[model samples]
Target chain A: MKILAAVSRSTVARVLNCIQVLVPKPHVAVVSLDEEAALASKAMGVEFIGGPLPEKIYAIDEFKEYDVGIAALDNDSINISVVKALRSIGIPLVISLLNNSANRDLLVKEGADYVIDIDSYVSQNIAASLSMDKWVYVKPLSIVNLTLAVVRLARRSILGVKLGELKSALRSKSIHLMAIDRLGKVISDDSVELNAGDIILLTGIESEVYEASMDVEKLFRRHEETLARSFAESLRASTRPYG
Target chain B: MVFALKSRGKVSLIIYLATEKGVRNVKHIYKSIEDSISVVDTYIVYYGLGAFKQLMDIPAFHSEPPYCRGKAILSGVNLVTSPVIVVINGDTSCFSIDSISNAVAKVLSGETLLHLSKPQTNTDFTNVYRSFLQDILGELGITQSMLYPSYSIIVGLRKFFTTTPYSMWSIEQLAAINLREEALVVENNSCIDSTIDYVKGFEKTFVKDLARKAVEIALQRNTISRNRAEEYLKRIEAA
Candidate 1:
């Protein structure tokens, strides 16, 4: 496949370099005047077009030959323009990296096949890794407008809970406990008990998966509070003298 | 930031941050600017664009990089009704109130329309670069006041900005060249007192980044620096 990457910042170049490293078959070409981007392209061995991106970007002859175009510029406006430009010239697939999430809808409106909310994805991953006891990988099923989240079962709130009990709880909130990945075995049976390190698959309508995740984390916090209160009462009773 | 005495003229402060991921400092910078909002007509600060779009309560223009710097300056100056502006680096550099007010006072007065204050660092590389540039501009018949290193503060009117369109050249060099008669340069204790080192060289692309600025300006102005500037740039490259 002929892939053209519109590079501006070092971050985009770094990502494109990774793609080149892992899958070396595609003929990737990068067009940019940014010195950092140029250096990255040179090191990665992608065909580099070194010059200012002309105002009439669609008029460039080399762009017409590509099957896919990636607009990974730093600016949202430029990225939006590149998406439109690539579509105008009849490229089959156009992917764009969104700098600001505010422009997410705008990229979709203008001919971008896939809009990666790059900034949002990065920050969310960092925050999730820091706050959550067990990591969850979530992806949207665009056709159904549903969300699929694969959550690792590690929190004390649901460590020994039966799969049937957990399913009924999630079902009360319109979520499905799809499957379990426990020790390389797929468990669709709900009678099985939940283990500490089992990976639980969840599917729910658009925003419900996120809500369920938060609800699970909240349960952990609530458990800690009640445990603390009960422990304090026990301590008081133990210290009291027999009257 | 500027103050108009007659009928409460408008003043705008454009804080262009240099480094990235300095979101923590925005609140401190914003609070300080807010205190002066009563005195100065209007001011807006944003860290390298994207981070401040939703973070700050005040009205700010949030943008990503790759903007034409000349057009960016003009667009900012035009936003506020006032043509005067103060350009400062928010992320890496901070200035004393005394020096900031001094720069504003110099611009407000008839003494100079373009006032530039540079940060004083312990290193001598700045001094060396300043002298070398001074001699080069001198040879080109561009008379200037005792020019300092990179500009940390800029207080200038629309005329000064229009005269030297701030293209690829540093604002300090442009201000010195265009506002020669009405320009003032000062060195205040700057980067050393800053939270981090104020300035650093272009690491990966120094040769291209450095050569382009001087060469582009020389070519546009049709100056004699076109032929001889390469020799000086080579020396800079070697160093």
Candidate 2:
């Protein structure tokens, strides 16, 4: 695709790097009035369209031939003008960069097709990545709104339950027991004995899976605690002389 | 988990957000899908904002500018490594998880595209417009019972999306073009495009309840950050 990027020298590297990843073999032409910007574009072997703001963008004779145009100038007014010029001439797509988030509506009104604000865009992505461990990170996990969670059985009572017995219980909650990690190995046997410390991998809606995990943990812990209390009571009764 | 296991780093889900209304719609979509966050591999939520920061404070949404729906769909399909891609307009909301699952199943089961068609839900004028659309498609030698291309929820294969040139044209125009062969239509989904629709739509059974359920699930799963999800629910209450 042939794309025209109207950007300052500072943003050239980042823009080009993003284009390389996103677009497959884009024929990018860098447009800037700055000689330094032009030199950078030239060094990168990009087609350089040189001149001032809106005027230089308007001067491109073959504007319609370009598939998409990008206006990434740091100055909002200049970027707005450049985007406006591209749209007025019927560029198929015109995307502009925003320094200030406030100019988003104005740019869209001025005929820019898409607007991207750098700060919020970058920070949001970083934040999402940092918070990844708490949830699933599959490439398409949230598309269908499914998550993967691995829960370990901590108490012995619940661990005695066989996978066959638990299948119907899990199915009732719409949770699928995907794999069983016995010691260090992954097993898929339905008759596999339940053992404490075994990790069970589950896939289902987040809420349901979490609920199932909580229920399993609570049932096991409560059973074990009750069993211990009853044994102590029996011993106390046996030690009484009147009995 | 085995079924959920992805080969290599292949993306299993692609979410392209059409951001004409802003990022609130994007947040709404994410919130609605909170209950089923386990099946997704990765998601790309690009606001059709070219180079500007987003007006709405949805941090997880990426800001990618596209000229129109076509460009956004094409761009998203190109950028994401997923085999399945879902295109949703930010302004439209209120689709059931079952509807989404059904659509995804259809795509994975060999349907080229699934169009979430809520026929006859709009006004008389829109119905007439849809009939006109059917006539236009007829003239183009495309014979279909219904020609209204519902843009609320579109599910299809990434390859199918990339090969089909559905961009350049509006939803109706793309429908008239009739580019794909294995497209399926799903019905009963609803969208709130305007204030009137919002009011009208909510007057229906369980609309508010569904929103409440979505908010609750969103909070429980941390699908969106707690603060953002709560803030959104608060706005709805105040409204």
Candidate 3:
């Protein structure tokens, strides 16, 4: 994917580096006023497009190649303006990083797709970690208004139950069981019995996922701390080619 | 440990140093791996002479200007007396004993022609530095062993480096490319991280030029077929 990271701070260099990592085969072009940010992005194989930040995203010829535009300017006003400019240019998706929380509503109104309030995101995240559902990993799938959850079954009643048995519950809740992360080898096979250290990945509408997550905690040794450690071990082992 | 025991003074270690951070990393790496009885000697390959004023006692080579990764490594490889040599990226953040010892063992055991690592702690985060033409380079039958020079900590036979030499911006890639199927991949945390300040300005055209030159070098080495290289050249140009 062609990504235009219109950055204003050197700190965004690490963010750009991360984008390049998470997004597979990303063609990231960073437009930054800061020389440090520009040079750092270039070093990470991201193209440092040198030019004044134009009113419209397409004004820079290289940006026309990019479908997604991210406005990460330091000021909320600039971010709003860049987001508006990007939206005007018909960029498929325009995401703005709101530095201040006060202008969030206005920024959201102006920025069509997303106005990410980093402060709120972090605080809410910290809040979530302290909640009763802390054992379950939940990430909001924004575009669809759905939630993807990884739930560890806390009880032993789920043992000997085939994965197929959960399909009925999943169907009733309208939440799909995406994959079973057992010691990290993500199993899509329903034939596999619900085993210890299995963390089930569920996705559906928010209400349904929450309901499923609560229900999942009642059965099997998909216990919280157990799967978190073992599943992580599996994932680490899988990514390491030598091991 | 057995590898170190069997290969005493039979293996030489060369650390490729480029940035200022690499100078410190080299000293850290030297001190960490100093007691390995398997290593015959340690060589520091820096960018220039001035970079090594404080780095006394260890024999070092200095490469001047327009830093080419291939030239720096091959130059050091040429001077090693050991049958096997391990070329490490000096910018790597602390080499662990486990990683170094395992690689040495693997090479000395004659299990593989070249042993390379996928840096879990690498600065780039991912193997994002995989050859620019990686998507299609496989079709051309050219495989890259060392995707990023920073992750180019490799243990291999000395003859492999002395022969089949191609020095461009991607000498390490070409070396791994030449290894073909004989390269072993080990997961290690020894790679330049984001903390290192190795910032160098480069334009798209310059990068494209480097890729073209890389393709040309591969074509010359018969590692890639002429037709495949031509197709890639066209594709790269269009891109």
Instruction: Indicate which candidate wins on TM-score.
Output: 1
CAPRI tier for the interface of model 3 = incorrect
> Which scores higher on DockQ, 2 or 3?
2
Note the DockQ of each predicted structure.
Answer: 0.07, 0.02, 0.01
Q: Candidate 3's residue-wise lDDT over A102-188, tens digit each?
A: 455556665548766664456556654444324454444335656666644435424455677567556668877855554677776
Candidate structures ordered by DockQ, highest first: 1, 2, 3
lDDT of 1 by residue, A1-243 (tens): 889888796665566855676554788888775788878777878778876442335557877889988888776655765786788888899888888665666577668888777766666566544543464544443335566566556665354455675565565687776555547687777787667656666677758877776665565566667777888999988896769
Per DockQ, the best of the predicted structures is: 1
Question: For each candidate, what is chain B's TM-score?
Answer: 0.66, 0.55, 0.78
Q: Encode model 1's per-residue lDDT on B132-181: one tens digit a residue.
A: 56655665455454344456567777556544544432444654554444
Candidate 3's residue-wise lDDT over B1-239, tens digit each? Answer: 75445454467888887777777777777766666646776777765325454465666555433265566676567545578887887865645667777777777777776776655434331233343545544544544433443454677787776554444443555555565564645455644355234333432343455467667767887767899789878876886
Model 2 bad stretches (over 4 Å): A1-243, B1-22, B31-67, B124-132, B139-146, B166-182, B190-239
Stretches of candidate 3 off by over 4 Å are: A1-243, B2-9, B48-50, B120-131, B140-149, B186-192, B195-199, B203-210, B217-224, B237-239
What TM-score would candidate 2 get against the native? 0.35
Q: Mark the 10 consecutive residues where model 1 chain B has the least summed lDDT.
A: B198-207
Model 1 segments more than 4 A misplaced = A1-73, A76-117, A122-166, A174-211, A215-243, B1-8, B16-82, B89-113, B124-147, B157-195, B198-212, B224-226
Which fraction of the native contacts appears in each prediction? 0.00, 0.00, 0.00
CA RMSD for every model?
10.4, 21.8, 22.0
Error of 1 at B172 (Å): 4.6
Top lDDT model: 3
